[model samples]
Target: MRVRLDYGKVGLEVEFPDHNTKAVLGLKPTVPLENPTKAIAHALRQPIATPALADIARGRRDACIVLCDITRPVPNRLLLPPILETLHRSGIPKERVTLLIATGTHRPNWGDELEALVGGDIAGSYRVVNHDSKSLSAHRFMGTSPNGVPIWIDKVYTDADLRITVGLIEPHFMAGFSGGRKLIMPGVAAFYTIQRWHCPRFLEHPLATNGSVRGNPVHEEALAIAKCVRPDFIVDVILDEANRTTGVFAGDLEQAWLTGVEFAGKHVRAAITEPVDIVVTTCAGYPLDLTFYQTVKGMVGALPAVKQGGTIIIASECAEGVGSPDFAQALWETSDLEAFVRYISQPDVFVPEEWQVEELAKVVRHAEVICVAGGISAEKLTNCFVTPAESVEEGLRMALAKHGESASIYVIPRGPYVIPTLC
Candidate 1:
C-alpha cells in the first residue's frame, strides 16, 4: 500500500507492504468552505453570544487585532479584510487600528513572512507590530489568576479600546484544544506568565491531556487569562486536512470557541480498538514541522495508538533546525533520560523551552521514539533520548525487525490534528 504523508510544502509518499499496514488514520470526510471569505463575513455579522462586530466597534477609537505567528495555519488573508471593513464602517479609522502578531516566546515574524502572514495589501496599509515577550517595558501586570498564573500582557493589546484575535481551532497536545483563549495566554503574554502556566506541575496533570477541557487546569487558566484583556471579539476557523477553511466561529471568545471545539471533536477524534506495534506520524506539515521544537506535538498525538514498549516513527521537515537553542542546551545539560526528567521536574527551573523537554519525556516514557528528518543532527537527537532515522521507510524497517513481521502499523498523516482514542 502507498501511504502519502503531508510533508513540508509538498508531501511525502511511502510504500508499505500491505501485510503490515493495519490502518491509516486521517481526518474524517468534511466539506471545505466553498468561499471562506464569505463565510467569515457572515460569521462576523451574525456572531455568537455577542453583538455584531460593527455594532461593537461603533464608538471605539483605537482597536488592536491579535494574530497568531508563523507556526499556525491561520488564514489571515481571507479573514482580515472583512474585519477591517467592519471597523471602518463603525467609524474606527484605519490609522487607529494596529495589527499585533502574538509571537509569545517565538522569534518575531518579519519581511516577506510578515507580508504573507497578513496579506501584502494589509501589511502595507496597516500598522503591524510583533509582540516581544522579553520586553518587560511593554507589558502590564494585571495581578494573578486564582490558580496562580501571573497575568502580564502586552500594553498594545490591553490599551486598545477594542481587541480582536484571529486563530485556528485544532487539537492541541497540552491545552486540549488550540485557538480562542490560547491567543491571549501564551499568545501575547509575558515570558514570565507563559513559563508559570507551562510549569512542570501542569505538564504532569492527567486532565492536561488532549480532547478535554471542563476539568483541565490548562484550559481553565487560559480562559481566565483571556478574561484579563476582556477581548471584544474573536475569529477562529476550523480547517480540514488540506488546510482549507471548513468552518468559522466568531463573536464572544468563550461561546464561539466552545462551538468550534465541539465541531472539531467530531472530525479530529479517531477511534482505535487496539494498540499498534509501530505508529508512524507527521507534525502536520510545513510551518508546523519547520522546527523540531514544534514537532513534539506529533509524538504526543501518536501516544494513544501505540502500545507501551512499541516503536513510534515521526517524520518532520524541520528545515529551521532544532529551532530553540535553549531546548538544545537543556538536552545537553542532562546525561540520560532520567536526569532530563529530574531537571525539568523542578518547580524553580526556569529554562526557556523547558516545556518541550517535559512533553518529550511523556512520549519517551511510553515507547521508543525515532525521529526521521535530515535537518536535525543524529547527535542532537541522541542527546534528547530519541533515536534518529534518515527516512520513515528505514525507521519502519528497523522497528519491524525488532517487533517481528506480524507487527501491526498505524499511520497518522496529519499528526496533532487527529486525536487517537482507544476504543
Candidate 2:
C-alpha cells in the first residue's frame, strides 16, 4: 500500500506492505464551513459565554491582537480581516490596533515571512510586531502563579485597552489542546516565565502528554498566567486536514476555548485496539517540520500507538536544520539519554530548550526512534539520540529487519495532528 506522508513543502510517498499494515490513523474528515467569513462573523457576534467582540471593543482606544507564530498553520488572513473590521467599527482605529505575533521563545519572523504570516496589506498598514521573550525590559511583570511560575507578558499586550488572541485550536503535544490561553501564556510570555513553566515540574507530569487537559500541570500553569493578563476576548478556529476553517470559536477565554477543545478532542482522536510493533509518522509538513526540534513532536505523538520495544520511523523535512542555537547545543551535548534525563531532572538545572529534549526522552525510553529528516545530517541526528534514515523506505526496511516482516505496523500520516489512543 502506498501512503503519502505529510512532509516538507510537497509531501513524500512511501509504500508499505499491505498485509503487515494494521491501520492508517488520521483525523476524522469534517466538512469545511460553507461560508467561513460568515461563520467567523457570526462567531464573533454571538460568541460563547462572553459579550460580542464589538461590545468589548466599544470605547476602547488601543487594542492588541495576539497571533500564533508561523510554525502553526493558522488561517490568519481569513480570521484577521473580520476581527479588525469589528474592532474598527467599535471605535478602535487601525493605528491603535496592534497585531502581535506570539512567538513564544522562537525567533522573530520578519520581511517576506512577516507578510506571509498576516496578509501583505495588514503587515504594511498595521503595527505588526514580533514578541521577544528574551527581552526582560520588553515584558511587564504580571506576578507569580500558584506553582511559583512568574507571569511576565508583553508590555504591548498588557498596556492595550483591549487584549485579544487569534489562534488555531489543535491537539498540542504538551498542553492537550492549543489556542485560547496558550497564545497568552507561552505565546507572549517572558523568558524566565516560560523557562519555569517548561521545567520538569510541568513537562514530567503524567497529564502533560497529548489529549489530556484535566489536571494537566502544563495547561493549569498556562491558564493561571493567562488569567493574570485578563485578555478581553479571543477568536480561535479549527482547521481540517487541508487547513481550511472548519469551526470558529470566539468569546470568553476559558469557556470558548474549552468548547473548542471538546470539539477537537472528539475529532482529532484515533483509537487502536492494541499497540503496534512499528509505527510510521511525520511532523505534519512545512513550517512545523522545518526543524529537528519540532520533529520531536511526531515521535512523541506516535508513542501511545507503538509497543514498548517497537520502532518509530518519523519523516520530517526539517528545512531549517536543527533549531535554535540553544536547542542545537543541547542536542550536541546529549550523548546518553539516561544521563541527559538525570541532568535536566535536577532541580537547579534548567535549559532553554530542554523541555523538547525531555519529551523526546520519553519516546526513546519506551521505543527506538529512527528519523528521516532530509535537512539534517546523519551525524547530527545521531548526536540528538535518534537513528537517522535516508528515507522512509530505508527506515521501514531497518525497522522490519528488527521487528520481523509479520510485525504489525500503524501509520499516522498527519503526525501530531491525530492523537492515537488505546481503546
Candidate 3:
C-alpha cells in the first residue's frame, strides 16, 4: 500500500515502518531554537551597556582572567567569543588574558577540554590554567566568613585587573541557586573554605542566608570578599534544557546571578509539589567525570526532595573511569568518612579531595544509590556504588516498586549535574 505523507506543520517528513502507520508528530532535540551566542551577546550588551568592551580594551589593565563554569549544559563556548572579542576590542591583548578553570570543588578540566570551551584560537593565544588546591600559596586566608569561620581564597583572584566569571543558575542541593556565591565559594576558594562548607553538612542554611557563616554561609561571604578585590565584570549565564545560554547577565555579580536564576527557572526547575519516593537521575557526565563523578550530582540534587532511604537510580557514562586512581584507592581503604576527614587535618592546608570524599561519604550514608553505566566494571561499580539493572527502564520499574507502585516518581534522564533545585 502507498500513502501520501506530509509533516508540513513540524517541517519534517519520514517513511513509516508498517503497512499502514498512524500519522505521527515529532520534535527534534537538536533543532536550533535560537542562536545562543547571539542571545548571550544581546543580554550582556544590554545591562549597563556602559563600559563598552572597547572602552575597557583601550585601558591600561595589566592582567585579566576568564573564569567559566564547566558544569554540563552551560554554553561557555558560545558565551566566550563575544566577551573575549569585547576584551580584544577594549584593547586588552589576548596574551594578557588567562583562562582559568573554575572547577573549585569539582574535578579539574584538562588542556583539550579547556580549548573546546574558549575556542582553539583563544585557547592557544591565552594561557589556560586549572585551580590548584594543593598550593598553599594559591590559597590565602584573608578573614573569617561573616559568622567568623575562616575564609581562605585563591590568590590568583587578587592578581587579575579584570575578572569575569561564568556560570549557570540552577537548582542546588542547599542553596536556592548555583551561581553568585558559587563562583567564589567552591569555584576558587582554597581547600580550607571548601572543607568547612562541605564537611559539617550545613545544607540547612545553604549560603546567602540572612546572615551567618555556619549556614552554607560561604557564598555571601565569598561575594563580599570578591567585592573587596573588585571584579571588573561578571558574565553570569542562564541555560536551557540543552544547557545552552538562554540569557547572559552582565554587570554586578549578584544581579547577574538573580537574572540567570529567573531565566533558568523556566528550564532547570521542576516543582515536586509532593515529595517523591523514587527519583531516577544521573550526574550528566561532568565534574562527575562524565560518569565517574557524575553520580554525586544526582545524589546532591535529589537528596532534599527524595524520601529518606528512598531509591535513587543513577546513570553515568564515565569513560575515563570513576575518580582519579588515588581517590578510588583511598575510598576502598577507608569506610570511615570522618576518619577520612579527621586524618586530613589541615584542609586549608591539605588535599581537596579528602574534603570532597567526606561529603561523598555523607551522601552515601543517607541514600540508596543505584547506578547504570557501561564504561566501568560492574563489580567495582557495585562495590563502591550501586549498579542497578542494565537499563533505565529496568531501573525505573525496580525503583518504582521499591517505593510502592503508587508512589510519585521523577525521572531525570540527563542525570546528576549542577544547577540548584530552587524552591
TM-score of each: 0.98, 0.99, 0.76
State the weakest 10-residue window (summed lDDT) of model 2: 332-341
Question: How far is 343's C-alpha from truth in model 2 (Å)?
Answer: 1.9
**Superior candidate under lDDT, 1 versus 3:** 1
Please rank every candidate by TM-score, starting with the best. 2, 1, 3
CA lDDT of each prediction against the hidden true structure: 0.89, 0.92, 0.57
lDDT of 1 by residue, 165-186 (tens): 9999999998999999999889
Clashes of each: 0, 0, 22
What TM value does model 3 have? 0.76
All models, RMSD in angstroms: 1.1, 0.8, 7.7
**Candidate 2: tens digits of C-alpha lDDT, residues 1-423:** 999999998999899999999999999989999999999999999999999999989999899999999999999999899999999999989999999999999989999998889989999999988999999999999888998888889999999999999998998889998999999989999988898899877888888988899999999889988998978998899999999888999998899999999988888999999999999999999889999989999898998999999999999999999999999988787778668878988887987798988888888999999999999999988888899999999999999999998999999999999999898
lDDT of 3: 0.57
Which should have the higher TM-score, number 1 or number 3? 1
